[model samples]
Target: MWGLQPFYIPWYWYPCSTVFGSFFERWPLNKLELGMPRLGLLHTGIVLLLTLITELFLKQLGLDLFTTTTGPTFAAIWTTVGLGFVWQFNMWPFTELSQPTKGIVASIASLIISVFLYLVTVFLVGQENIIQGLYWWFNILWVQVFLMAPGLYDGISLWQDVPPLVEEQQPLSLNSEGR
Candidate 1:
């Protein structure tokens, strides 16, 4: 258990720095890729384990894991994983199914969904411990979003590989040419 209190220390700094820094800059961290299918799962396990450890650390620091407000935090994590497949495919927003857009939409959509779910969870659970719950939720989801970043980008990039929707040229008939 980490000795630091839940809100006493700057919790966001470590997770935020680790999350974004490792994600975009690829700075001070591991390169997790969906291409390595086996390794990807292993990496996911490692991340989830670390999250549990952090929560336990917070608990050791006297933070209650089951407080009503924290319920939404837990829900956000569940939401992230639930949306993983759709996010990776850039398949949200049914209206844009035919559009050739990048995976940026998926990431943004995922974030919005996560936030919405968190709020809903908090509303159902209670607002007293919402901050604590959000703290945990965001930390875990941050890593999830980071891990999914590559796959999501790949899905978007995959669109570029597709040929343009141009009109097909007709083949001339052999008989017509002879005639």
Candidate 2:
């Protein structure tokens, strides 16, 4: 299942992007503004927490769930929902576009990107080795890096806007003052 590897990437990446990316994006807005350092830490913490919860949920569901046909279908649906609704809504909270228009655009964009990833993965690996396929597909590093991108952007933006610290004047010396 060469296709399975790409499916796995988006399956993990999109949801993290939608949920964490959306919330992290708001850190720059007035409603949820935080200092850059704090925002970075908070973003890391949130990602870790979400990853932990997801791992626990999957573990509870058992490995057999992923080995079944239902696994891929469920993953596809999950990724679609994240990209279509969650990512779009979070990415464009203050857009002037109409709701339906935004939704259609988001859905199409998400579908295209997802399909492209799937095709690329399938083409590169070509369904030769199942073990390698599983390893490549299930790698968590891709998901972590994807989720960190927005935070890194936010951090850089915040860093640039920060005012430089001014040096404090030293008190006059008693000798210099002729005490």
For 1-179, candidate 2 gives per-residue lDDT tens digits of: 55663323234434544543533433333355677888668766665565455545554644222344323433443454433344334445434544445444654455455445444554666534434433554453346346634433341134566687987887677696645
- Model 1: what TM-score? 0.31
Query: What shift in Å separates residue 106 of candidate 2 from its native position after superposition?
Result: 16
lDDT of 1: 0.47
Model 2 TM-score (2 dp): 0.33
How far does residue 123 in candidate 2 sit from its true spot (Å)? Answer: 22
Writing each residue's lDDT as its tens digit, candidate 1 over 1-179 gives 58853432223223322332222232112344445677546645555564556456446634344443443454454445434534554443433533223233433454455556666756765667676666766776667677765555433233555787997988767796644
Which prediction has the highest lDDT against the true structure?
1
For model 1, the stretches where C-alpha displacement exceeds 4 angstroms are 6-101, 129-179
**Winning candidate number (TM-score):** 2
| Candidate 2 segments whose C-alpha is farther than 4 A from its true place | 1-14, 23-32, 63-77, 87-179
- Residue 69, model 2: lDDT of 33
Error of 1 at 52 (Å): 19
